[model samples]
Target: MIKNVIVGIDPGTTTAIAILDIEGKLLYLHSKRDWKREEIIKAILSFGRPIIIATDVNPPPKSVEKLASSFGCKIFYPEISFSVLEKQELVKAFVYKAKNEHEIDALAACVKAWKRYRSFFTRVSYLLSKKDASELFEEVIKKLLKEGKENVESIVEKMTRKREEPEERVEKPKEKGEKVLEEKEKKLEQAKKELEILTRVLSKRKAELLTYKRIKLSLEELEKCRKELEELKRANNILKRFERIRMKKFEPLVELESINSLELEKLDKLLGLENRVVYCNSLSNANVLNNFGIRALVTECEEEINVANLEFPVIKIEKEFIQDVDGVKCVKEDKLESLLAEVRKSGLIKWLENYRKRKENY
Candidate 1:
């Protein structure tokens, strides 16, 4: 007999009382400091039957319309405005994900101050229907400005009789004296081609005024050497901050002296060493301390590890001697000594135990 439809709320001092169920999910979200009128009529008499009470807290106070007319339910006011402040910020971000995110930011500032007090009758019925549609659009713009001033005075009296019939025609002074001597020889060949284009534009305006005075004296000597190199870089950054505050007040008296010995002469130069190896192999158990310090010895095979005398090679292994070597994947010597003690605790057995202690000290 599933019949429980409750949407009862009286949340004002800035709105909130949500109850929605007929599949509109949010079955209960109450606020106005958690209901009061007998816990909102015992949550609408425990939703046993009569429901539906959506009240964006409007003029609903004659004791909440006598408790929604003694609970027979049905009370829906819902017209808060400013688009209910984006539905009270999506109902205070989903009731601040179920409760107090600072009381859903103080119930979204009391539902934006109860939708600005129910937008004063929606702003006085939108300013009395915009003053009755602006006096019916100013009486249709004064009857289209009195029919555009009687069609602009009847097209200005028919363009004043075609301008007095082209000033009554006068002509023959002996055929205008040979058409005024061929229009004065065509105005003397257009004044001799405008005086040869004004003497080639005054010699290109005196060569662009001497290249605009040499680019305005090279932009005022590059703005006075950029203000004397910004005052010598602000006095060399205040003398490099007073020489870094006198080298931080004499850095512990120059790190307490002690520096005059000089004898560094071991120059068998491996020029800036980086994993170097050199071994012109006179194979005396060619270990080179099993691979970490040989820097040169190539009699040949060079291919550019900087050519001349190469010899790095020392990663040899060959011992736990079981030879089922054909693509060997055999394991058991107690799982190869627990996988070589987890590959010698992961430093890959320090270059195979320094190449088996340089082949057991040769």
Candidate 2:
């Protein structure tokens, strides 16, 4: 049998649920400080099947929405639900002494839903039995809201017509000969029951066979994945043709770039510089660079600006600096060109190889 009731919820740190019947009578109103969603659902359903579910807030709380959806009922919402102050005022007439805020909010929502639909409920009750009317109310209001009164009247008229129609039937008298065949029919029924048992056993075996096939296919898929992994490793090995001699061949360039010294020497211990590279729009970033104990690679200095007593090597470069690309700073195309121009051929080749190794590592 379809039960008819309304449910309201206030979901929060303290969860509360309120239920009302078709006649606007309270069925249940309770709260839990620590609540579980499943228990809320269970409690709402335990009261009676919901005809309408409601909540007091706009953007109704997710837990409240979920409970309403699970109930599969018409949900009611006032154009704008009351504010906290308004709820206390509205609930005062019906509920004088509420235990807490959650209970008051919940009951207030239920009262609002009842007030909104009471007139409609009264007219529906007059049209049909209360049981029949409430069963149809969820459907009726949805259509009435979407279409209009005319559609709702048509639906009522159709239901009345179904109720008024008389059922008709005809029966043939049984013969004595039919009684004679009953014994044979009983034996045939017994044979059919045995056949059904065999059919069920066959179905179980077929399901087992399918399970075996799926297991075999899964094993094959895993084997294919292992082979693909091996192929990838071999591909990596094939591509690294110069891995054996890159370091030894990279030695001479170290000298080509060595004379580039005394960029800074015998300076003050600016304990504020070690470990991180800092970028600056201008040489003015020198103060920030000195304040923090980290590496500083300044970008806007066209000519070297050597400040006295500055211990850190705040190298100024004329090129774009790429952040953390394969473990090197300033590895962009322009930076590579500036490096080649400064260090000449041997160093350039070694730098190029290091960049390639970094790219491969990435």
Candidate 3:
């Protein structure tokens, strides 16, 4: 028997189809370009009998309406057209089954229809189980969709009574015929019991299938969270390394591009040259250093600057005494103090004698 199904269609140049059984389980998804009406009908019939035809839009396309008419199935469309984002979300869990946007939209429409009637289907299952007519699940569901709920209760009552009714007994003169009739009734009751058992088994399998789909979706989400956690761990490691570097003591040093009067004047105004160690490439402005309450000078001079009896020390540039911490150039305080001690040991630094000698030569 062809199982009852819901058929969702995307009717366009490239037509797409999605089929779901009455229990909302996915059955088939396909798309074909420029498919004729006859071919579409054939493809749908191959899967199962469609009890309802669904579309994503409120005012469904004429092609979809025609297909529903041809199949004599009920047409289902939402009150408001489903947006792209809504369609995407509806089918996100089953996205892997859809090969294209058309298939996704079709699946979304079918899923929406299933959700609308899912509660009603559950109630039908309950009522049928109460009446011991579980074997009438498919037939009753088909009628419930094609007909109405009120009619379904009466239909179920009639079907159950017909199955339970006993056959007529023959008179005692026809003993052989009576035996044959009794045997036939026994076999019929046994078949009904077997059919009910099969129906229950089918329902259980459908429930298991739904559980598997949910678990698959949960695993996908877990994978995404795992990747995000790894990224956060890597970022934290980098921050920790930077934190360690920041914990070290680093002395701030002001670097001058040139020793010209104007540049030094601007630097002194901006950063206050007082008690500030100034570094420069040349010592041409060494004579002006004492005007500011400068601590010392670090220069790349080949010869020492002989500022006439200047109290401030002049240290030559040493790569070992400099360190760059996070893009800011700084001097090593311990190394600078050791270099200053070595300079002071020479005794007054011979400042005046050297200045006078260099002046006379110039």
Candidate 4:
């Protein structure tokens, strides 16, 4: 008699299969790379006839549906796809450890299907126990599950009654030929059991080897990432050091309340402003500024300063350009250089005009 079993399949580049007995006990679990449909069917048949086929995804895969059709079994799938966490939780209680994700997924799918019909299994078991016909359990369940239309009590009653019936036959003396055939059958059964044990051992070793290869690859990838992170951190540190050096190049501006004869004279005496950049409100004594050897003048003057005659540039600037650092007003060296470039361009034009005029006069 063919035993009824539930089969779970995870199909992909790596296909996995898990089998559970009618009692929800795990009978077999295995996975292979690029397993063909025919190979899978052959492997599943080695366990028993499948009563149900299951998967871990919703909108069941066509491959799984086809497998179920091949077995003439019912298909079971979750309404939503099972998460990684859920799959892990489902398999945690089992003593068997799944070597890879595919195996775990197949096992989880089988467990889910068993849980779904667990109540019906319990009811059938209860009915059989009351009838005192535990031997008919597998036969009755196979009928109820496969047909799904049969009354459970009726099946139990019919099976029990059949078991009670006895058949009468004429007895003949046992022949030596019959004894030899019976011995061969027993030997064949023992050989089949031994082959199954060896296959399980071989599959376990293959799983271990596959797992080791994957772990090695993962370690290599982690090392590569660590090196990249270190390089990034080193680059970031170099940038921070370069920024500190660049900040040192900026000089604090000597603030002037206003730019006039008195202020220019006072600053010249106080700081010796030969090449100092000064900030002020307005330019009053442009002539005096040219004499002091002031490098450039920054101001918030709305009206333009006539710097055509004076050698130094009188640059108009908004308040945003000035940055206060450590209680001192300073401008970034790059920002100051850009402002100076604009001033110099105008100054150069004015100088070129005057030089041409002097040459013409000569």
Which stretches of candidate 1 lie above 4 Å from their native place? 1-186, 200-206, 247-362
Clashing pairs in 4: none
Candidate 3, residues 208-295: lDDT per residue as tens digits? 9999989989999998989767766754554454345446754555677766778677556545678877777767657777788788
Error of 1 at 31 (Å): 99
Off by over 4 Å in 3: 129-135, 150-155, 162-362
For candidate 2, the TM-score is 0.41
Q: Judge candidate 3 at residue 89 and give its lDDT.
A: 87
Give the clashing pairs for model 3.
none
Model 1 residue 128 lDDT?
A: 33
Clashing pairs in 2: 272-293, 273-293, 274-293, 274-294, 276-295
Cα displacement (angstroms), candidate 3, residue 288, comes to 99
Q: How many clashes in each structure?
A: 7, 5, 0, 0
Which lDDT value does model 3 have at 240? Answer: 54
* Cα lDDT for residue 40, candidate 2: 81
Candidate-wise lDDT, in order: 0.42, 0.62, 0.79, 0.81
lDDT of 4 at 289: 73
Each prediction's TM-score versus the true structure: 0.19, 0.41, 0.42, 0.40
How much lDDT does candidate 3 score? 0.79
Please give the lDDT score at residue 186 for candidate 3. Answer: 100
Angstrom error at residue 27, model 1? 99
